[model samples]
Target: MSQSHTSQFALLTQRRFAPFFWTQFLGAGNDNLFKFAFTVLVTYQVQVAWLPPAVAGLAIGALFILPFLLFSATSGQLADKYDKARLIRFVKSLEIAIMAVAGIGFVTQQVAVLLLCVFLMGLHSTLFGPVKYAYLPQHLSERELTGGNGMVEMGTFVAILLGNVAGGLLIAMPGVGAQYVAWACFGLAVLGRVTAQRVPVSPATDPALQINWNPLSETLRNLRLARESVAVFRSILGISWMWFFGAVFLSQFPSFAKEVLHGNEQVASLLLVVFSVGIGIGSLLCETLSRRHVEIGLVPVGALGMSVFAIDLYFASRGLPQPAVSYTLGSFVAQPGHVRVLLDLLLLSLSAGLYSVPMYALIQMRAQASHRARIIAANNILNALFMIASAVLAGALLQAGFSVPQVFLVTGLLNALVGFYIFMLVPEYLLRFVALLVSRCIYRFKVHGDEHIPSHGAAVIAANHVSFVDAILLMAASPRPIVFIMDHRIFKIPVLGWLFKLARAIPIAPQKEDPATYERAFQEAQRVLREGDLLGIFPEGAITRDGTLQEFKGGLMKILQAQPAPVVPVALQNLWGSYFSRVEQGTAMVRPFRRGVFSRVGVVAGPAMPAETVSLDGLRERVGRLLAA
Candidate 1:
């Protein structure tokens, strides 16, 4: 598993990239660890205070979240308007200031000041979110985005769990004290700042970007851009939903550990440790499961696990005795009966991890390049919205007299139902679901030399577009997902558009009617390859009306000039005979012999050719020959 994770880690260890990954990781770690420390101190250690533990818990959570609502707008704009590396350095420096205050508060036992620091850190993180997400497309390719985000998420949760354990252990230390724990956080903050200095310069995407001073209006503008594509918007919703689940589950750990498992806060921290580790594990698994692309086929699968296990957790805890809570980890192990709680914890975190990583990748892959940062800002806004709602929902449920187990049961069942309903309505998840399913369960894919397609970054796939199903078929056929240059009309289809937008397929039109479309398509094609995807284009401009291939258009020439990614010409022979076969077949059933279920979906790839060989007529002639052969 470590070896499998090496490529993902390369993004971190490599000098050009590692600093940003660590900067973001350390910042998140510091944020959660401090919040955990404050929450633990108020809820357990002090036991004397001005307010009840529940009120303090809610206030602490609120303080961290309020910053996202108030400061994300400014931070997101700053990220777009300046060099991200510098902005990150500035943020880390701010952390040093916040941590210094936190250390003073911890030693003085000033809970209000600690909560204030939590709010400040939340504000710091809000500013970092856009920078964190937007920085990647500048450095990594489309292929690397999914894997990269997986590593980020995995690292984050692992850090979170470690910080939780560290906070509890440090405060309870016999010789050491809470002040020392705060100093250790401050030390890590300094380490993060040093790493930030090493991050490569990512120049401003919009140096002239106007700062929207009003958080509400700016947040609204950002969401409007995100909603331009239903698929992109849906991805945002999916991500926000995970945060919703996370906030609820994370907030309930204390009650869950006490009344249900009959274990103390230490066991509570252990449950969190198990869950966070599971999240990191599942996140890393997405790279292998998705084959290193932003394949969101796993989102619904994650949702399934969330709902299934939640229900089972409810059942698992039904009859068990409510043993007295114990602070020592050994007590739960001694009882040997609360193992089910442990399983539920691990499964819930694993599901949450799987749900999140792909959604992050999808937003990056699909958003307009000029406004990608803003789209991520919109995502943060929705995430904030979801998290707030989760808190409200949990409070309402509990106020209505639902037990912790019952709430778990309900949320879990709702997760499954919601997931199934969404997949059924969209069908893209199910389509990719089927594509991946048939891919793994039925036919094994055999790619001879994927290296022929650019290994480190992006490449162009110039194929004779033969049918309406050509792009999706090629998507299913290739080992790597391809960003196709498709017609504007096809992108409007119901189910197909859902996935195309998700795949970030560029749309083109005639230069006369829509110069904007033509210019945008060429620009987007270049961006797609530059972003590290295989840019597939149909030089024919349209599917063949006659059986013979048409003349290759100048679009290919234009794309070659824009970026000059190596071109791999592809040919499709017998694909027109099946249901999708444009060769005018009987329904899907009538087309087959050797071509039964899939028929022979023949696709041939020629050796890499020079961009100099990329002439309109010459490339057309070669593709025509390959089609005939």
Candidate 2:
């Protein structure tokens, strides 16, 4: 499927891709919806029973996470051993059964039984986790991976918000009780099944391999596979850290709202809203920020802002006398000095958006083709472990009589520490920094109309590809990192693959080589524009062997017409014959670089042009002149 064929939701109405999106969307929705209802029920309606308030809180938290630790390993293996589409349908069917069981617990008002269901739901999610991440690479093109991940992330967040809002409102409604929640779950499950039916069948990548029934062994196996590539492992670490960071903050929010801001649920929720919207904005900006390929440069930018706001929040809460605990949104809004609290929430979330989107894209790009889902499962297992640890660490602070504000300060400090720890271990961030350092330290490089690249929206970037190092150079040189549309074959090239993986290039090929891809790529490009990203494409389709630009292809015309974003014409010169570029035509062609030395490189951005002017000949002529200059 080409971009034009699957550009729209209607045109993309295919079986392989659509079902997984719906399955994940509905799953996210149900997960949050139920959690919201459960939290409200446990906190407000249920009487104190087998445990103390704090104990119950801890137990509930344990219940929510236990499934991931126990089942994720098995789940990851399952994805590798079976057809993903059929597996998804099976999972949806299981959801229907789980809903029925949940209905009984809700109606009976049995806390233990309800707790069982929470664990069960988590178990369901655990099983689906690996399948969820792995299934996409099978379905979408490399060009579409980041955009598709962005859509899935965006959709998941929106669905989560709606689910949480609905759960809270529904649990309090007359006549519905928990039964209504169960019914909602059932309805969504049915819808998911319908979508799954439309999903194209994805065959098992390794069905012939013997199934590993042992969770511990299988879990280790998956991690070993992921670690085969250093960048892949680092990407998994980045993802795991997100779960850790998320668990730390989200766990503390209620306490922070109650003790620090002295505001009600509404105000606290307002904090959540700002963060969610921020992330949504960031995820959408990936296409624009990344320039339509795998641009992880924003990760550093996101991390920087996250730390700054965390520090600002430390000051924001100072000098304000704590108000009596209130759960009303209005009461908190009326309080003096609560504005900083909201801003803190927004900043944390906005920066989080910058941090996470690229991590997901990186993982998707780097994981091995055959075991992507299992690798994702390994990631989930680590995420569960880190989140559980995050909860315990956060809980220890709360138990030690530390106020929520104090906890925020400590976690903020820890976030900065952990982020630095990971960056030190991986050095992609450091590598990017070094790349920029060398650029600034050694070469006087300049990029024009990068603002034309769109600061907050999506745009098309047509560049002339002359070397294999184009992605690394573009990512390093551009004011905002751009995502490059690339050749699928490049994804398998060793260390280059890691570099490509870190940058998040979307690898593509002609339909003759890969018939069922790039449809999603176009859809993802549209998604980036919607989210405000600068999508970079090589209209010539691949690097020019002759060191000359080739004619543009058909997809750009369709993409530009559909998206209608500004087009940036990028040119590269003197990158040829460098260490990362093509020097010879043999297997031992690549040579190592000198330590701390720099390659002479040049990148220039021409003025922004309309999509109409970004046609095959026009873009080529403009970039040709720029490259020549």
Candidate 3:
């Protein structure tokens, strides 16, 4: 309810978020702790005929993710049909039971029982995954969604890192390592259950919905529901691709540190620490970079960084001299070349954090509340599939005699291709990227009273246009998409025109000049408002030839009469003499660097006026006041 909280860390102090954060944090820590300890036990100390040491880690991982592929659909349905808080408590209770059995397996050294417990733990996670994502939207405002998700993501990775460290340390003790690990797992599970009991009540999104028990049918249905929103579905695919890209690096860390970097187990652990810390830092940075909104522009930036660093890592890993002795963590860090390798790994993961958090937040913001959990379930299914494919592909590459660094190169190149394909499919990402560049780089853009723009429903933004890039700047300031009504002539310009077309800006001409185009533009604008989307119009009819206010036109009045939506007055400041404006002899963009780069410019929005009360003069007066402010 405290949407005004500016810092993401503030959520950690609140009842609405704190208990749930700890509950999930402990669950993730416990999951990693038990699994890693069991892995070490089997791979190092105890050996089994059925599960060879070479394949023990792989087999355990496969079993753990198997439930996501099998039961995610049902779990999503349950999350939608029941109170998430109660479901979380129930899942934590199940963790306690599973950990109890795992304790017995550890004490008795029963490999089969431990493996069975692994599958059950996987089931527990599958059930909790939907509840975890669905609960946030219910409790947090849209302003807090990105920050909330970032905290959770950062916490999840940190917990995993700490859990793995604890597991590895506890499992290496003299004779009681397994017993210690058992007790630690049981304690963490109990703590998780206790925390879950304190989580605030989160009611079901679709309490009246019928339950779907069949996984295959329910999965197909969930996918269909996700496909209802192209943005949300593509976001799911984007997130899955990220997992695929990451799994390649994560699954190869041991081999990479040993074979490529010629380092010992400590060096591998050091790589994990760097990666986990980098991702945590990037996740926490999203709230600040996005200004507490779901800004998908960062996705392209992240994708680009991911590929660049991944490719660099390939080159960094090559041509190292073989050392007589395996390098320890300290010795590895002492080498300058190894530092580049670590830096590449760190930056790649940081980019991944940026890439993923927004898509998750976008899915939460855009998906229908009724089936949001089901869509997240679909995402989980896809993520599982992609990770599996990543493993298979990496195996195939290595089997064909590709070195670890070569595998990294191939994955990075694939990431670039995949990123290009996704961005082309969704031009909104590209539009936002351009908008971000224009606002952050071309000018030192600032926004005021942006919160006055409605977060949802239909509205019209009536602003006094000053430059060709006003729409792009407005796009950067807004949290939602706006369909701008622009001059038809402007659509003939080169790069900006293509971007405007991609943004689906409705091109209008004067009624006397082109009556049909004018009518069609107005019709499209009306339809956009009727469909509860934002519509942006210049309202002054054309950009001013001189650096002064132009008389407002009646187009806004016509739009209000037809759609009856509130109109928000906006003003563009300090851009009249800029490069894109008609500054020199009524010609625009003829002079380069007219205002120089990063020149001061601003967009200020006034409070919305009721549709019935709005008039041409009143709106113009409001925008004039905003411009002068």
Candidate 4:
């Protein structure tokens, strides 16, 4: 729980996480597998009196989504009110019973009964949704939150890929047919129940709270809880938007492959497989990319990449040879510029992982534990709504005579707008833009002792400011967001000043120069710490003219004594010669481009010490040792 394990995969070998993870994985797979098999049956084989196949597809989609709208509020409350492990077992048991009924429907081939199965499966998923996500924060350490969520998401997409493949293959089998699909669902349900049984005890978050059985009122209550925190609410919106975007892209894959790429079924399958693989790989890399922290900085970067690749995909698909013969998967890849199109799809999916994992982690980390499940349920409701809107919009556009590629072009452009609006709404997303730009593009950055940075709670980062960009490097490398306390002159500088404002950096002046400004800066810094946000300051007061550590100022001690927060010692290494630094030893005039591109730099964090024990000498010594290390 301390995040002692460095690798996310290491969690798979731990008892606390392993069973719950597999239970969810198998359960997700079964849901998709059964749904795909049934949909295919409804589309091609069944001769139903109720509706046509196209209409049936819409009906089934509506039926599945209806349960989330109706039942999610109740399920979210139940998760908070009961032992989660036991609740999971109950859900799996229900799954088995539903599968048993589904088996009967399969044999009878009753369209109404199969539709009932679809609705039942949706109900099961709705109940499980909150429990699955809310369970992780209870088990994983905060440092593990991002990695853990990433693993779950990667596993989920992998399950989806396998489930879709297995569904089609099993349903089309000669003798087994629907029976094989039914048996598989039942077996998976049983296995899920077995795994659920092995899950560690997860006590109710709020057992004493009374249940609200009224769906409509309870649903509104959950939505209110989700909106309680603007950050969490915005994060939920980001997630819902992702679902909308994904739904639009995936809903068109079949038609996109056949009509646009002029490819057969195998080619469609190939596109899906590539997309899934890319997402899975990207999800796994999130932990490393984020430096084992819940780095939402990747979210804006992901949104940017997603839109860019989607637009490129439109270009990659344009003016292609329309052959008389349908292309096989191999032939599709072999076509001129087709591989580029595949790359776009893969990158688009990869960026989807980047966009989503952090947002999920952010919600989990920030939401109140007592109402976390209900908040997730609220998110589910919105996701369903957005997805439904996507379907309707896509249908309307296609009806209005837009090509699939053209629709993608429109979707991509709309994504850019949506992503920009969200970033404007939440400055955290914009801050991530700064972190990503500096860390990924400007510098080859590395961090050591990142685990020493506390995952939560108030702390002051006392670092030696070796250069103007020292704060930038520290901001990028720190596990948590840091509010740098800097000189007002530095805070007033051009483009850098704008970034400082976005980062919420507190600006100070010397008491003699401006007492009001100095006092205000201290008040702001204390406020940040009291609010449990990280406060970063250069105890050296300004960037060093020489690379050697300067005598620490007394202001840091005064601030720490007043606030009583933990002090984390940070040292920026190998940045003295950068353009932002006074590298010539005594000159104010600075070169604009001396460090060149992709300069190697490092940040090292020492263990956090009590604020009571913080001193100018002690912090300077600690940071000096770290810099020398």
- State the displacement of the C-alpha of residue 508, model 1, in Å, after optimal TM-score superposition: 19
RMSD (CA, Å), candidate 4 to true, equals 2.2
By TM-score, the best candidate is 3
Residue 484, candidate 3: alpha-carbon lDDT = 99
Ten-residue stretch with the least lDDT total in model 2:
1-10
Please provide, for model 4 over 264-283, each residue's C-alpha lDDT reduced to its tens digit, 9 standing for 90 to 100.
Answer: 99988998898899889789
- Alpha carbon deviation, residue 566, candidate 3 (Å): 1.9
Q: Write the per-residue lDDT of candidate 2 for residues 1-629, one digit (tens) a residue.
A: 01132332331365656667777888889878877787777777777566555566667767877888877878877888899888888888888787777777767767777788788888888888888878877776555666677777777888888888888888887667777877887787778777777777889988876777788888898889989877688878877877787777777776676667667777667776776777777676675555444556667767766777776777888777765556477766666577776777777777877788778777777666677888888888899899888888887888998776677677677778877887777766655654544444554344433434443356777887776666665666553446667777888988777666666567666777676566666776677777666687878887666566677788888887787888888887776555545556722236655222465567777778876656677777888887877
Clashing pairs in 4: none
Could you tell which candidate, 2 or 4, scores higher by TM-score? 4
Better of 2 and 3 by TM-score: 3
Clash tally for model 2: 25
Candidate order (TM-score): 3, 4, 1, 2
lDDT pick, better of 1 and 4: 4
Q: Which candidate's lDDT is highest? A: 3
Compute the lDDT of residue 504 as modeled in candidate 4: 85
Please, what are the lDDT tens digits per residue for candidate 3 over residues 90-147? 9999999999999999989999999999999999999999999999999998778999
What TM-score do all the candidates reach, one by one? 0.77, 0.71, 0.98, 0.95
lDDT of 3 at 23: 96
In model 2, state the lDDT of residue 299.
74
lDDT of 3 at 145: 91
